[model samples]
Target: MSVENKKLPQSYYVPAQSPWPIVGAIALFFIAVGSGLTIMQLNNSNVSGVFLLVIGLAILFVMLFSWFKDVITESNNGLYSTQMDVSFKQAMLWFIFSEVMFFLVFFGALFYTRNLSVPWLGGASNNVMTQQILWPDFQSFWPLLKTPAGDTTQAMGWQGLPLINTLILITSSVTLHIAENAMKVNNRRKLQTFIGLTVVLGGCFLTLQVQEYIHAYTELGLTLQSGVYGNTFYLLTGFHGLHVTLGLILLVIVYARILRGHFNDQQHFALQAGSWYWHFVDVVWLCLFFLVYVF
Candidate 1:
């Protein structure tokens, strides 16, 4: 490659037009509508929501496959330059930032429920009827044990399974970082070893997480309908687990590409993006460990 080809003006930046975005948007629309209808059908017992949700997810998977294929084709064709690398970096940064905001929304809601809503219901401020008429035994506290409806559950502590998962995720993040740095330095053996270790560690964390959930549900009698404690606990951890699953999938794709001799030392944006995503998932798990498990 010529040095001139390595650098290009921003004005020359042009990506091929693709229809995947529109298709993805349509799929999401179906998902939103289907979920709404499904919730509304809770009492009537209709099944349209299930059908729509499945179709929407299938469309989404198709869109992802098509879009990723196009990208890989472009990369293999040598159509991308250093400017494209910069664009990928910027795009990944913005994507992670958006995800940070997504988690922040949920965390904010958790905080609001714990600090505001619970107190108001317990008559901490003005309304004495909050205690006199409703919830006479309601006690406002973090890692809420009881819901306003009187359902109770034991809070998940930070000492056992959660702490182990936290350590596992953190170690995976470190190994992934080592793999990324190895890639940058063209240490292919080290890169493979680190990435493989990272993948194994991630799998371990997920396995432990499932065990924890089982212990919570079966051993501790904690369940989704147990109360707000169970609700928030599941919501936060479940969302984080979904992200971890996605990160694992991305890592697997990168590993396959590596085996195929696809990415080079300097041109491994997909690998870097996957690493960033994995690390982001790890950090989110840390926050969840502190807030959800540790209190």
Candidate 2:
């Protein structure tokens, strides 16, 4: 074969060892410890736990900023190849799968508590003697607003703010899809407009969620201390809210990249990943609405 006709072996780019992973791990450790302490100190009027939490979050944010900056620079420099793109896509898929399992555990807990545990406690399946001895007045209901311990809380209904938030999320997902379509057609104006709308919708959803929480705590007498119902409600919805916040951050980053002429129709894995995550968040909210609010 002629020298000019010889095929060159493809080279894979390997990034140098970096400190960001360790820094991120340390930040997570601080966040976990700080959050635990904060929860423990809820009634003690201690501010140290809050201080730690803030520090941890600040460090985390810095780590993310630096990490993403490095990634963007590398991409802009044409460092990534087709293999790297495939690797990123696979990583994002696995990440989303892990998130699905993470939520499945909580949903499983909700199901078990509702279908089996509560029923057993209420004298189902020949446990009459058990119920009689344990608590004769305890009732087995779906919401279980009135706990066996005599703590009562109103259940959050699906008619008002939650419904509105659900619609907003669904609409945001649609808007993001439209943005993706616009990206495919190389219509920067349409892409930016749709994504901007999606971001606004996300912000509105979060605002309404905060208002809903305020209503629950102040007006509805619902709180973490209310009982198992309250515990499940807050944990599920609160975690979902955190996911929504993360999705919003990702969308904002994608929007900034779009403004900077970062992505093209054929190579926009970051935008695709962000869209997948946003869709996942929307689906989770739908489940939460049906399970927690409606039935």
Candidate 3:
């Protein structure tokens, strides 16, 4: 936008043309292509997907940094009025709402399969004829490990890594809150320490999640192709993990800004935004722990 001071505005702030939007769009394209290729790599030994995925992620990281830097620069330049703050907050809320809807679709699928489809296939209600004509020996059970073609795979247990990761996420949420409070009080040392702790906890959660995936594939016979159960489980947990990764990056950048004294207690919207996102991630994980894992 205009490189002017944050002065009184007679109207709402209208930003000047920015290339960041196009740059972000390009990053998203690379990510989509890379993700499709990586999924294809499960069957074929194509390493190009991994290469593309890394490049896409790198570009995405840079794009986010540059875009945020521009906005923060504008804010510091006093170009943002109260109206701009409200707009920022409204946009963030809408973005989070969109994320909620995205996950709701997946969760709805899980509910449909577990509560309806499985039983229908097992001869529940009017599906008696379906069972007899399909597989008379079919048993309706959670996980549905045995495919119709007789491919047998084991179900993942909720007891080990899943439980540990849940606890880690909850703890990280607490630490983030503490850091937020510390920032509000201008306790830089406390804020930095707790933020560091939260980031470490996030890293640990990701590492353990990777280990869990490895265990699932190596020992539990679980994979994306396992069945409906596997599909829901991986899709839910995998997307949540990706969100956590993004939040971790957000916190890292916020930490850097904090160290540079870019925010005061009264005007730390960036920190607030990051904290809001991380808390949302934590809540999503709690849902997954119960609905996707334990339940």
For every candidate in turn, the CA RMSD to the true structure comes to 3.7, 1.5, 4.1
lDDT for model 2, on a 0 to 1 scale? 0.92
Displacement of the residue 3 alpha carbon in candidate 2, Å:
6.9
TM-scores of the models, in the order given: 0.85, 0.96, 0.92
Which candidate has the highest lDDT of all?
Answer: 2
The superposed Cα distance between candidate 1 and the true structure at residue 259, in angstroms, equals 0.9
Better-scoring candidate (TM-score), 1 or 2: 2
Evaluate all candidate structures by whole-model CA lDDT and list the values in order. Answer: 0.84, 0.92, 0.89
Residue pairs whose backbone atoms clash in candidate 2:
none
Off by over 4 Å in 1: 1-13, 29-53
TM-score of 3: 0.92
Tens digits of per-residue lDDT for model 3, 200-292: 999999999999999999998888878787878889999999999999999998988888878888888888899999999999999989998
lDDT of 2 by residue, 1-295 (tens): 9999998766577999988999999888888889888877878999888888888888998998899889988989999988899899999999999999999999999999999988988999999888899988878888989876787889999999999999999999999999999999899999999999999999999999999999999999898888899989999999999899989988999999999888988999989999999999999999999998999
Which is the leading candidate under TM-score? 2
**lDDT of each residue in 20-84, candidate 1, tens digit only:** 99999998998888877875685677899978988887898799778888888888988887878
